[model samples]
Target: MKPWLVVAWKEIFESLRDRRTLLTSLIIAPLLGPVLFSGMMQFTLAKENKDHEQRVEAGVLGADHAPQLLLWLQAQGLKRVPAPATESLVTAAVRNSQPKIVLVIPADYGEQLSAGKPASVKLYVDTSDSDARRAGERLQRLLAGYAAQTAALRLMARGIDPSIIQPVVTDEIDVSTPASRAQALLGVLSYFLLLSTLVGGMYLAIDATAGERERGSLEPLLALPVSRDALVAGKLLATMVFAAASLLLTLVTFIVALRFVPLESIGMSANLGPLVALQLWLSLLPFVPLAAALLTLIASFARSFREAQSWMTGVLLIPTLPIMLAVVAGLKPTSALMAIPSLSQHFLVSRLLRDEAIPLPEMLLSVGGTLTLAALLSALVVALWRHEKLLG
Candidate 1:
């Protein structure tokens, strides 16, 4: 057997024999995001269903001025309660949360309507609630609709054409694709995926390098007839496998859960297919090697397990940098866009979400460049593996 293959097989065996660590990585694979996302989607769905069922309990002050309008409110499915007489009473009801919204008609409500002037109807709603805002908007719109209908009737009664008074009707146009719609939304998927992958590899990296050294097994393994380069190569290959496994497992769970989630019914625009998800994972492969190499080097430099785990946390935080960039920059993925590290992957996934194609040549360059960096890091690790201080 080749020396590199021999060391790689040994490390792979060592990695497997630690059943506790293997189980831990496996457990983390599906648990982290699936549980969180399911709960979040459930919560959002519950909120949407709850808000839809709300009957906008409204408080009305003036009964005499618009008895017809009060009946209109009742007809619109808004449950009306009599508002308090004074401003103080309205303020009290608002503070106590007894009324979700209140409407006040001024003393001159009839006079303004008779004079063809706009009448003031104050709507005090719980601004803290977005649902309340929508409800209030609907109430205001329904009031305007009633006014328009009444205006048409009045003009027709006066032997005037209603069409002359209302000349223009507006039709809205919205131009957004599946990808652009996803762009408009913030997917918790990206954050959780990034976090899970980084943290998932943490224990594995610690065990693969620092744990081996602390247990005094790494030196003997290094003492084997195999060259240091082969030993480093083999160990790196094993670590990469574990990282990729953790990442893949996480990806599969999330993809399955996303497919099962009722996102459209809940008023969100996200489509998570197996293909798009696989692309996302593929984009992260370079990062896995980079992460493993970084963690391994850090662990190799650290004198103790305590030091290794502590230092590796900072290693775990590096992916968050790209997350911040992707968010602030709002980058759209393109062909040459892959030249950027975190941005490239982010754009690639975002583009896929946007239902855009990942350019083949760009994908090759970015993935190739990222892998090249990982290779250089491997060489650096081999050099560190030969260092007397790291081994001793």
Candidate 2:
């Protein structure tokens, strides 16, 4: 048998024996991808459907001034409850049960409106609550219309044209594509995929390098007739296979989870088909070598598995830099940006997600560049393995 196969089979058997790693690699990681995606879909669907609600459960502190208006609002799906004695009580109830909106109406609301001397009423709303905020906006529109009708009625009694008082109008049009509309939401998914891929492989990479070194097996393995290059190649191949497998598992689960969702609710055109999702998996393939080779090389440099684990944990964090930038700046996937490790996957996956055809040339460039980097790193690992201090 080839030494590399022997190494691979040995490592695989050892890894299989460690039930925790086996469970994490095969079951936990796979399930996590679906659970993560499904959770996000549920949250988004809940948020989007909240607006189509039949009624807005509102609490008012100063309904006395607009009792009639409040009654009218109730007729229009706006149910008002009297405010509780304390805000904390309201918040606690809101946290536990059905939706609640606490509206604090300032004192002296009716007197100022009746006086007609620049009367102003203050309304306190929970901006953090989407339901509350939507209710607030709807209520504001209702009040504005009420005020306008009231003004017109008063003016008509005096025989004045209220139309002249409000001649201008404001209008808005939304021309955003569904994909572009979901940019922030999609950007979040990109971050998650990056995280799932990078952190997912950290354990395997740490084990392949540091674990081997610590187990006293690395020195004897190096003493065999097999070249250091072959050994490094075998190990690098093993780690890449592990990372790629985990990444592929997550991508598949996430796609399956998305299938249960109504994509239109989140401003996406539709759920991805098997082909498009498969494309996304292929797009992330390049990152396999990038992540594994990078992490394995870095971990191999460490003296101990724990030490390597510590260092790679921080290295695993480096992707957040580009991810956050992509989120805030709304990055476009241009050709020049394809070589940036995790960022490359982010760009390509997002593009492939929408079923957009990635140019062949650009795809080759990314794949080629990543493979070259992987080769260079594997060569470096071999060099390290050849060293007395580093390997022994």
Candidate 3:
């Protein structure tokens, strides 16, 4: 057998024997995405369903003053409850009563409307309460609708066209399909998918380099006939294998979990079938070698297994930073941006999730750029292994 292959086989065998490493890398890491996504979707769907079924109870402080408005609210299916005497009481009612919103109409509300003057209606709600916030928004829209109708009627009586009062007609048309729209909800899944690659090979990289050195085996192994470059290559190859396996497992788990999620209820669809999973796996392939080489390089500098783990924890954050920035800034993918390694893979995965066709040139640029960087890093790792401090 080739020297590098022999070393890689030894590393893989040792890693598989460690129960802790296998539990974290093979089992927990792969299962994390599916479990997390499923739990979040279930919670969100349950909350939305509960909200839809329950009727909004509105407390009306001066119901007698605005009979017409009360009728309009009733027509919109809002359940009316008798409100308290004062504004302070209305605030208390929102917190204590079943009513999520309290509508306070002034004593002169009817008089002002009859005289064609503006009548003030105040909504008292606990903004901290999500249910109250939603109820308040609905009440605001209902009031606006009533105001517009009244204004149109008044304009008609004055022999003026109501359309003349509005100079512009604005229409907003959404171009996103259900799958594209669902990307917002499933954005975190991309981060986790990319993260699996970094995490899966981390333990093996640390164990092969720092752990072996700490156990006093590295010096004896280095004295062998195999070249330093081959040893590094062997470890790099092992790390890449683990990373690739982790990514593949995560993609498969996501495909299965997505099928059971009630995404259709939220007007979103995730078609992560076998073909999509295959495409995602292909797009992520180059990243495995890149992540492995980078991690192995860092782990090589550590003096002990625990030190390597500490360094890797900080290094793993590097790949996740781009994903965080993309989420916060709502980054759109461009050809130039595809040259960046982790960022490129993230954009490709997002495009796949949205069911958008990736341009051939951009795809080539991402894969080529990542592979080139991986080769450069691997050379650096080889050079580092030749240095005298590598033993210290």
Candidate 4:
């Protein structure tokens, strides 16, 4: 057998023999993604159902001035409560009471409507509160409906068609499929999948490098006639294998767990079919070597196993940043993004989840870019191993 292959086989055998390693790297890590994702989705769905079924509570100041408007709000399922005595007290009342929205009808509201003049209503809400925000949106929609009705009545009184005042009618068509619509809900899946690749081979990489040194086995292994590059290549290959396995397990576990998730309850569907799983796995394959090489390089610099583990904890957080930024900034995938390593994998997986076709050029760019990076990092790891301090 080739030296690298022999070393890889030995490492795999050793990792399998250790129950703790197998449990953490293989079983627990893979299962965690699916379990965590499903749990969160379930909780969100429950909260959404509860919110939808509950009535929105609102407070109205100067209710007598806008009796018709207040009645319209009540018809829309807003439970009216006594408003705060002063405008400045609205915020405090909303924060302390169950009312999420307050409508302040001005004292001049009835006078303005009676005189055919424009009047404004003030809406007080705690924008920092999610429930208040939702209530505010509902109130805005109701106010818009009331305004449209009043406008129509005024046009009728003037013997003019209401359509004449509104010259253009806009129609909005949503072309997003259920899978695409679910992208927002499933966006975190990319983070979890990429995280699996980082964590899967972490322990094995640390054990192969710093753990071996701490146990005094690295010096004896380096004493062998095999080239230093071959030794590093062997370890790198083993780490990649474990990482690949972890990525596959994570995908499979998540796909199975998604089957039990009631996605339709949230008006989203995750089509995690076998083909999608295969595509996701293949799309992330190039990243396996990159993750392995990066972990091995970092672990090689550590003086002890615990220190290597500590460094890896922070290193693993790197891949999650791109995903978070993409979510926060609402970033779209472009050809330029494909050149980034972890970010590229995240974009591709997200596209696959959205059931969008990836262009051939984009796929090539991502895969080629990741492999190029892995090759460069592997060379660095080999160069580092050639030094005496690395073995020490």
Candidate 5:
């Protein structure tokens, strides 16, 4: 066997023998994302279903002033509750969460309606609260519907055509497919996959370098006849094996876990069938070497296993930063963006999830950019291994 192959086999064998390494690489790292995602989706779906079934209750400060309007609101599933007499009290009640929202009808509201003028009704809600905001939005929609109906009736009573009041009407058309709609919620899958890939290789990377040094085994291994290049190659390759395994398992686990998620309830469906998974795996394959090289490079600098773990924990967040920034900036996949490493993988994975065809040039740029960086980092790792201070 070649020198690098011998070293790689030895490292791989030892990692398999260690229970901690096996547990992390085979189980925890791979399952973490799927389990969390499943639980979150389940909870969110349950809450949304519950919210839909329950009637919205809003406090009314001057219910007597708008009896007809109150009846209309009640018919629309809004339960009217007794509210405070003053606006200040109603605002305080909403802020205190006694009621999520309040509808205040002014004394002249009926008079304004009788005179054919716009009658303003105040809706008090705390915008900072999500539930309150959602409730407020529902109330606004109901109010708008009521206003439109009332306006049309008034036009008919005046012997005028109601449709003439509105010259333009719009029919909304949604062009998004089920898979594309799901991508809006599942875009974070790329971040999870990238993180898992790095994590799977992290223990092995640290074990081969900082761990061995701390255990006093690295010095003996360094004294061998094999060149430093071969030793670094073997270790990096071993790390890549675990990282690749992790990446694959994470994707597979997500596929299985999503099966129980009832995504159809939200009108979204994942396009992660076996063929798509294969495509996704291939597109992400280039990232394995980059993750391995990056982890090994960082671990090689640590003086102890604990120190390496601490450093690599922070290193894991590095890949996520680009994905976060891309989401925040709402960036589209451009040829220039494909030149970025982690960000490129994110875009590619997202495109696959959206059932969109990736341009050949973008694919090439992503693969080329990732592999080039991996090669540079691997060279740097070899240089670090050759240094005398590496023993520390």
Candidate 6:
């Protein structure tokens, strides 16, 4: 066997024997993202379904003041609840009580309608609570619908076409495919994938460099006849292997978990079946070496295993910053942007999720850029290994 192969096998053997490393690489790191993603999706879908099916209950301050309007509201699906005695009391109740939303019909509401004037009403709601906010929005929609209906009836009474009140109307057209729509919900997937991939190699990186140094094993290993470059290559190769396994497991778990997510409820359909998963896996493969090199380099620079773990943990989140920025800016992929490491993979995975084709040039740029950076970082790790201070 080659010197690098021996070192690689040795590192792999040690990692496999380390139960904590194995657990993280095989189980925790891979499954954590998918489990959390599925839980969030399930909760969001359930809440949306509940919101659509549940009736809105509105407290009316002066139900007697607007019997006709109250009836209209009731007919439109609002269940009127007993309101507090006064508007002040209603506001106070809404601020701190059972009913989260309240409607105050002034004493002149009916008189204003009779006198052909615009009637004003107060709506008290606790906006701090999500459920209350949704309920208040629904009540606002109900009120708006009633007003429109009343306006149309009044226009008809005057022998005028109700459409005359509207000069321009809008019909929103959604051009997104089901798969593309799923990208909205799966926006954070790339972050999770990259993070998990890096995490899979984290313990091994620490073990190879900081842990070995702390155990007084690194000095003896450095004294060996093998070239420092070969040692670095062997260690990074092992890290990449574990990272790749973790990436594959994370991808598979996400695909399986999404099957139960009810994404269709939100007009989304995750295109993460076997075929797409394969495509996504390939698109993200170049990132594995880069992640391994990055993790190993960070760990190699740390003074102790605990310090390496802490530093690597914080450094892992660095790649996610680009993904977050891309999402916030609604950035579209361009050839120039493809030169970025994790950002490029994010763009590629996003395209795959949208069922779009990955341009050949962009794919080359992503792979080339990632591998180039990995090579540079690997050289740095080799140099670090060759340093006399590396024993510390």
Per-residue lDDT of candidate 4, residues 195-291 (tens digit): 8888889988999999999999998899999998888888999999889999999999998998888888867789899899999999999999999
lDDT of 1 by residue, 214-314 (tens): 98988887777777777777667777777777778888887777666666774555666788778889877777787677767777787778898789778
Q: Give the TM-score of candidate 1.
A: 0.83
Q: Tens-digit lDDT track for model 2 on 200-268?
A: 566666777788889887787778889876776666667667666777777777777777777776557
TM-score of candidate 5 versus the correct structure, residues matched by position: 0.94
Q: What is the TM-score of each candidate against the true structure?
A: 0.83, 0.82, 0.89, 0.89, 0.94, 0.94
What is the lDDT, from 0 to 100, of the residue 286 in candidate 6? 95
lDDT of 6: 0.88
lDDT of 6 by residue, 356-382 (tens): 888899999999999999999988998
| Span of 10 residues, lowest total lDDT, candidate 5 | 47-56
Model 1 CA lDDT for position 46: 72
What's the alpha carbon RMSD for model 3? 2.9
User: lDDT of all the models against the reference?
Assistant: 0.72, 0.70, 0.86, 0.87, 0.90, 0.88
Poorest lDDT segment (10 consecutive residues) of candidate 6: 82-91
Query: lDDT winner among the candidates?
Result: 5
TM-score winner between 2 and 6, please give it: 6
**How many clashing residue pairs, candidate 5?**
0
Candidate 3 matches the true fold with a TM-score of 0.89
Model 3, residue 198: displacement in angstroms?
Answer: 1.0
Whole-model alpha-carbon lDDT for candidate 3: 0.86
Q: Candidate 6 at 384: error in angstroms?
A: 1.1
RMSD per candidate (Å) reads: 3.5, 4.1, 2.9, 2.8, 1.9, 1.9
Clash counts for the predictions, in order: 1, 0, 0, 0, 0, 0
